[model samples]
Target: MTTLVKLDHVTRRFGDITALDDVSLEIDSGRIVGLLGPNGAGKTTLLSLVQGLRRASSGTVELFGGSPADARTRRHLGCTPQETALPPTLRVGEVIDFVGAHFDNAVPREELAAEFGISELLKRQTGALSGGQKRRLSVALAFVGRPRLVLLDEPTTGLDVDGRRALWAAVHRQQDAGATVVVTSHYLEEIEALAERVIVIGQGRVLVDDDLSAVLDQVGLRLLRLTTPTPDRVRALTGVVDSRPEHDGSFTFFVQDADVAVAELVRSGIQFSGLTVRGATLEEAFLTLIADSPKQNDAAGVSPRGI
Candidate 1:
């Protein structure tokens, strides 16, 4: 596979704050890779370096086998950041044209708009559209240049269910057309739906990088949710990785093995009810990684936000 983007021992800082630390990864061509992390986990900082919007503080960032800082190297790249501010006065078609004008042989506005399910809004001014519609337009603009590598940060932030699904379909189509996509989303289900490989970041460092199934399986955890009168004792149960009390007077336990954990709970004579055990979802695994990270920098004050 072709390596489209590479970061070697990269670190980025804002004043005294380190947003990304000693990061090294390669984004291969034609894969939908999900970048998963909590807020302020340095996801955006990494993407910014890839897009040449910011320079790495200590190491190298390469795009298309060249420096990301070079305009020529980024010609085949497209990015939709966490926040998009479209010109209110510009019509949807006008905005597409404006962004497309910078690239050679850009996709036609009509074609690009149709692919992203925004064809009907072409005549409307950006200010007049709904939040979902505006988000669709913003994402569509990224593909106007027919990029080979697309970086999408929180692409479906404001979209409804159907809208989000439609964008997922659009993303699949992009991948089918031989584009590499890097997506960062708070929605773990979104990553599960669209990504084959997952790279999880936490505390300004990579915590997990593996195939989707491997990442899930590696956690080897089960979620046990039950209403226990003695929540404090439930948290200290053997095999429990972490425990959280739900808003509705229930405790959720992340356990190494549900059966063993449940057996231990029952043997201990804890008064609990409404017990349900299931395999840990991506969200659970991601959270477990963050909580168990050797480098716990969350207490170090807020840094950059990825989405």
Candidate 2:
């Protein structure tokens, strides 16, 4: 696949603050990438540099094999920022037409609106639209130019469950039609649902970058829940990562393998009940990554509250 964007040891700073560290990455063509991070993790700064909204303090940022700040690069780059400022007087269809006019090969206004589930809102003025409606329109506008690379920052910010699903479907359609998309969100479910590849960012650095499955596997955290009299015994067992005592006389054990842990529990004759074993979710994997990056957190002055 082609390389649509590449950052070579890039660093961006605001006078005294370094928003992005010496980071390097590559986004290839046709990949759905999720940029996951907590507040002040430099997610927005990284996207801004890519969109040519800001220049890197040092190093290089390239789009289509050229500087991201170039007109040609901007032409092929479409971005929907977290906060959108649309012309209040412009009707939805008019906004679409106006944006589409900038590109030589734009998706038809009606088609774009319908794909994003905003067909009925075509005639409504931007100012009169609800928060969710405006959000949908903002995301749809990114595809008005038939962009090859689209950056969506919190695209489903104010959307309900159904609306969010519709937006996800629209994004899937865009990816299927050959658009490389990068989405950043506070919602882990959105990232898990939309991203094939996941990048975990923390303290202005890339903590984890891999296939979504690989990330979860790397953490290798499984949970075994059971009512036990002695939580310390469970914690001391080999292969058990950690054990926490719950209020209801149950212990939750983090383990590498659930079956092995259960076998050990049975072999020890530990008098346990209400056994339940389950795999870790993305949230658990994320917490594991953060816990392992204490040095990075310190250097970046990141307190637990920051996350």
lDDT of each: 0.86, 0.84
Candidate number with greatest lDDT: 1
Tens digits of per-residue lDDT for model 2, 54-129? 9999999999899877777778888883435988999999988988888889989888988888899999999999
Least accurate stretch of 10 residues (summed lDDT) in model 2?
A: 298-307
- Overlapping backbone residue pairs in candidate 2 total 0
What residue pairs are clashing in model 1? none
All candidates: CA RMSD in angstroms? 3.3, 4.1
Give the number of the best model, judged by TM-score.
1
For model 1, the local distance difference test gives: 0.86
Q: Worst lDDT window (10 residues) for model 1?
A: 298-307
- Residue 140 in model 2: shift from native, Å? 0.3
